[model samples]
Target: MATDKHCKNELAAPSADQCMDHYGCIYENNHLITLMVDPADGSIVDANRAACSFYGYRLREFRKLLITDLNGGQEDDTGSFLDRALPGGKYRGNQVFHEHHRLASGQHIDVEIHTGAMRILGRDCVYTVIHDISERMRSEKRLRESEERYRDLVELCPEAILVYSGGTILFANQRTEKLFGIVKEELLGRSIDDFFIEKPLSSSEYNKLKAMSGIKDSFRIEQRFIRRHDRRVFDLDISGVPITYNETATLQLVCRDITQKKKETERAVRLQEQRHAVGFPLEDKAVLDKLYIPANTLSGDFFIFHRISDYEVLGIIGDVAGKGISAALSISALRVMFMDSLHSGLAPVEILQDLNRRAIEHMGEDYIAGCCFHFDFNRGMMKAAAAGINEFMYKPGGGEGMRITVKGTPLGMFAGSTFEQTAIPFQAGDRFCFYSDGMELLFSSDELCREYEYLQGKIAGSVLQDDCTWLSLLIT
Candidate 1:
C-alpha cells in the first residue's frame, strides 16, 4: 500500500494520499498557480500555495470555490475544456486554454491554463497549472498591430516592391498585383524569375565575394515581363537591391514600367537623324563658313542663299520662335512660301509681306523672325528688310561697321502689319551677314568679342556683317 512516508523516498503508483508529500512539495515550491478540481463538478478539491496567494485566498477558502467560479461563470467553456483535457475520465493528456480568472480581491487576470487528468482518492480530478499571460498577450497584439500598419504603408507604394530569398518570393506589396497582374498570395512562394521575361545576372557576373564585402552595386535592368492575369507583355525597369530581411540576406526587386517611354525614345532618335537632312549646302565662298550645331535633334535657326539674276543673290536668314518638331514644321512651311516670293522678284518689303500672309494662311498663327537681303553685284546696290528682325550691321571697304535699320512687326499677329526696307549703295568690298538672336546667348562677353574678331578676319576683303542684336529678356 502507498503511504505519505513512502512518497518522501519515491513516488509510488501515484494517488492523492500516497503522493501528497511529493505533490505538496511541488505545490508549495512551484511558481505556477496550481489547483486540483473534481472533474465531475468543476469544483476545486485542493489548492497549492501559489494558487491560494494568486487568488487572494487561503488554502481552505480556495478549496470551497469551483474552478468555474474562478473563471467567471465559464461552466460550458470548462466542460468543453474537460472533454478535451480528460476525455473519458481515463486520459492522462493535457490541454491549454486562455481564460480570465477572478481573484478573491475582485481583480481579474488573464491566465493560460495547462490542465491534465489525475486520479486522486480513486476519483477523476483536474490538475491545472495556470500562468498569468496578460502581458504576453498584450505584447503579441501590439506586434500584430505594428505588422498590419507596415503592410498598409507598403501597399500604397506606387512601385512594385518584392522581397525574395533563395530565388523564391517571400513578400510583395499591393502594387505587385497591378504591376505584375498576380495576387499577393499567388506571388508569394513562387520562383522570383517566373514573372520576368528577362533573366537576372549572368552566372559569371554574380560575385559572392564582392557581395559579402558590401561593395556590390545594385544591378538594374530594363526588361520585359508577362503579366500573370492578362498574359500581356510589358516593359519594366527593375533594380535588384541586396538587403537583409527578417534576419536573412535577400534581394528586393523594385520595378517600374517604361514600355511607352522606351518606344517614344526610340522614335525620337530616328526622327533626329532625319531632321539633319533639312538644311542646304552652300557653294564655298571665301567669306562664309557655315556650321549648325543644334542643342537638340532640330535647329530653330536656318539660312539659305538663292541666286536671283546673274549679278543679284537673295540671302535669307530666319529663326522660328521655339524649337523641336512644331518649330521645325513651321520653318518648313515658311521656307516654301519665302522661296516662291523671292523667285517672283518681289521687293524685299513685298517679299516679307507675301511670306507673312502665306505663312499665316498655311501654318495658322505663328511667330517668325526673318531677314532677306538682295545684293546686286553689277548695280552695286543692296536692299534688305525683315519681319520681327529689326536691324543688321554693315561694313564697307575701308569703313567702320555700323548697324542698318529695317524694322517690321512679327508675322501672323495681325493683317495690318507693315514692313520697311533699308537700301544701301554697295562697293566691291562692302559686306553683310544675317544670323539668329540665339547667336549672342551662345557666347560669353569675352567669347563674343573673340568670335566677332574671327568673323572680321573672314570678311575683311568684300565685307558684309549683320549686327542683329535684338535682345529680349536679355540673355544673362
Candidate 2:
C-alpha cells in the first residue's frame, strides 16, 4: 500500500507545487551536481547540496553568481553556449560536453553539463545537471601522449611501419610515406590494396593473419609493393603481426626495401645464363659430354675445356669454396687467369701455379678445390694434376674405378703450393667421370662409377638440387 502511494505521488502528480517538491527531493541529495538557473539572464535561482559541495559554495552564494561565472573561460563562450542550448527559449540542442569549468577555489576541471527547460513557481528556469570529467580527460590526455611517443619512436625506423585494423590503414609512419611515394595524409585511411600488387588484400586475407597460429601471431612474405603515384614496384620483405593497439585488435606491418638485392639477383641469373655457354663446350663430342646445374642464380661449380693442340686438350673442373655470386665472381677471375696463360705452352702444373698467383692477387682468400688435366690423344695418355681436388675414374683395364684424391694446398691459400701431377695411360675401354661435391650427394660411391643415366634418374627436374657439375671424358 505504501509503494502504490509513493509511485502515485512521484509519477501521477501533475500540480506544480507537488512537482517542485518532488524535483527538489530528487536533486537536493543527488550525487550529480544540480542547479536551477534563470536562462534569460544566466542567473542561478537555486542550488542542490551536490552543487554546493562540488563548487565549494552554499546555496545563497551560488544564487548570487551567473552560469558564466562557473565557466573557466571568458563569458563569450557561455553566451554562445546558452544561445545554442536555449534558442527561442527552448532546450533543443545537445548538452554542452567536454567544457572547462571552474570551482569556487579557482581550480579548473573538465565538465559535461545537461540543460533542460522547466517552469518552477510560474517562473521560467533551466535545470543544469553537471558531470565532472576530470579523470576521463586526464586518461585521454595520457593516451594521446603515449600514442605520440610510440609514433615518434617508429618515425626514426628505416623500414616503413604501418598499423591497420580490418584491412583499413589507420596509421603510417614517415618512412612509409617515403617508401610509397605518398604523403602521410594520403597513406592514412588508405586500404592495404593500394600498396600490395602480388594479390589483392581483402577481408579473408586479414582474417587469415588474425587467425594465424602461434603465441605471437605473425607472418612474413617477400613480394612486391607498388608506389601509388608512380606505380613503381618495389621488392618488399614484409612481416605482419596481430597486436593490441589502444585496446583494439590491430595488424602492424613492417616493410623493407630489397629492390637492389633483387636487381643483383637478376643480374646474377643473366651472368649464370651467359656463363653456361662458355663454361661447358660441346664442340668436341669426341672429347667429352658435360652437365651443369646451379643451386642458385650463381654457380659455385664450374668447368672449362679447350683444345690446346691437335693431340692435346686441357680441361679443369673446379668447385669454389662458397656459394652464390661471390664464388661465381672468384671462378670468373680464375677463368680469366687460366685463359690468358692457356696458349703460353705452360705445363698443367705450371698453368695452375700461375692461376694460383693470379687468384691470390685478385680473388682474396677464397680457396678452390679443382683438378686440371691435359688429354693427349696422340700419346694415348692423360696427364692430370689435382689441387686439393678429387676425380673419379672407372678404369675397366684395372677392374674397378679408383677415386683420384689430389694432395695439394687449395688455390689462393699459399704462394708456394704445388699441384701433384699424375700420368695415366688412356685405354679405349675406360671411362672417366668428374663430379662436384654437390653432385656426389645424389649418388652413392658405387653409383658414381656407373653410367651417367643412372644418376640422371635421381634428379627430380632439369635443375640440380645443389650447385653441381658433371664432365665425362669418354675415350671411345
Clashes of each: 7, 0
Best by TM-score, which number? Answer: 2
lDDT (0 to 1) per candidate: 0.66, 0.74
Sequence-dependent TM-score of model 1? 0.46
**Model 2 misplaced stretches (Cα beyond 4 Å):** 1-158, 164-166, 199-220, 225-231, 239-252, 278-287, 341-345, 397-399, 461-465
Best by lDDT: 2
Candidate 2 has an lDDT of 0.74
lDDT of 2 by residue, 1-476 (tens): 99999988888747887777888788786988988888888888998898999999988899889887888436444455467458665777545644678899999998887887877778978778889999999998999999889889989888899887765777888898778777878877777667555434333433443332442668777765566557777887878887767787787889889899889877877876676666333244244556677777678888878766676778888888777767767777778878986755546787788778877887787888788878777777777777766555645554787776656667889988877877788766666777777778776666777666666666655455677777776675
Q: Candidate 1 on 339-441: residue-level lDDT in tens?
A: 7887555578888888777767876666778887776666667788888767666656666656676878777766778888988876655556455665544
Instruction: Give all TM-scores, in the order shown.
Output: 0.46, 0.60
User: Which stretch of 10 consecutive residues in model 2 shows the poorest summed lDDT?
Assistant: 206-215
